[model samples]
Target: MSLSFHIGFNGQCKEAFEFYAEYLNGTIGTMLEFKDSPVAASVTPEWQHKIVHANIVIEQVELAGGDVNPEQYQKPQGFNILLGVKSESKVKSLFEKFAIGGEVVLPPQKTFFSPCYAIVVDRFGVPWKFSCGK
Candidate 1:
């Protein structure tokens, strides 16, 4: 079976997905807004334009996310989405890009298991870890 991940955003799914698509060189296969979903009536007027669901494909990996109601929103913690890359330059580039306006937990450096490794939290509050095998 194929495995994938789904993230819950605090009303920033659209923007976050867009950013991820661009930075990761991924393609957005689907982006469904709340106003276009059958559950549109359940969300507040302000959230009508928010994203109900979004999916992107990055190197054959599928990533999905959606906006959650304010009452149900929670800051992401205790986990990180790890990306295994084959290029050191690419890993460093991504580390710099993802660190903008976000917290950098660990700067790019060589580790025992990888040529390069780092951790950063994106502006959308999603934690990410990069491991370069090259």
Candidate 2:
């Protein structure tokens, strides 16, 4: 079985999915909300901004996500979403796209191991690594 990556969005999953879909032409495969699921009874109105679950596919890769109850949205210590690109243009394009309202730890540039590499923490605090094929 192919395993997919999961992201926990405290309350901005829809926004992230929208941005990725728009920029990468990623398809939103399916969605299931907490209020629509059996857990609806347990979800509160305050969690309105958060998404219970959303599946967005970019170039066939599935990025799954949902909101963690605010009272339980724990911070992550480490881990990052790594992206492999085939060209310098792709690196620049993706770096700029995800860097909007986000922090860039390093600008896209050549690294000894790869043609280009960059690191960034998106507005949602999810760290990402971008690299162009050598």
TM-score against truth, every candidate: 0.95, 0.90
Model 1 over residues 50-97: C-alpha lDDT tens digits?
999899999999999999998999989989999998888988999999
Mind giving the per-residue lDDT tens digits that candidate 2 earns over 1-134? 77788888767778888887887788997667776777777878776445788898877788898888877786544888888878988889988988999999999989998899999887876788889787
Show pairs that collide, candidate 1. Answer: none
What's model 1's overall lDDT?
A: 0.92
Evaluate all candidate structures by whole-model CA lDDT and list the values in order: 0.92, 0.81
Off by over 4 Å in 1: none
Kindly give the stretch of ten consecutive residues in candidate 2 with the minimal lDDT sum: 43-52
Give the Å shift of residue 72 in candidate 2: 1.1
Best prediction by lDDT: 1
**Leading candidate by TM-score:** 1
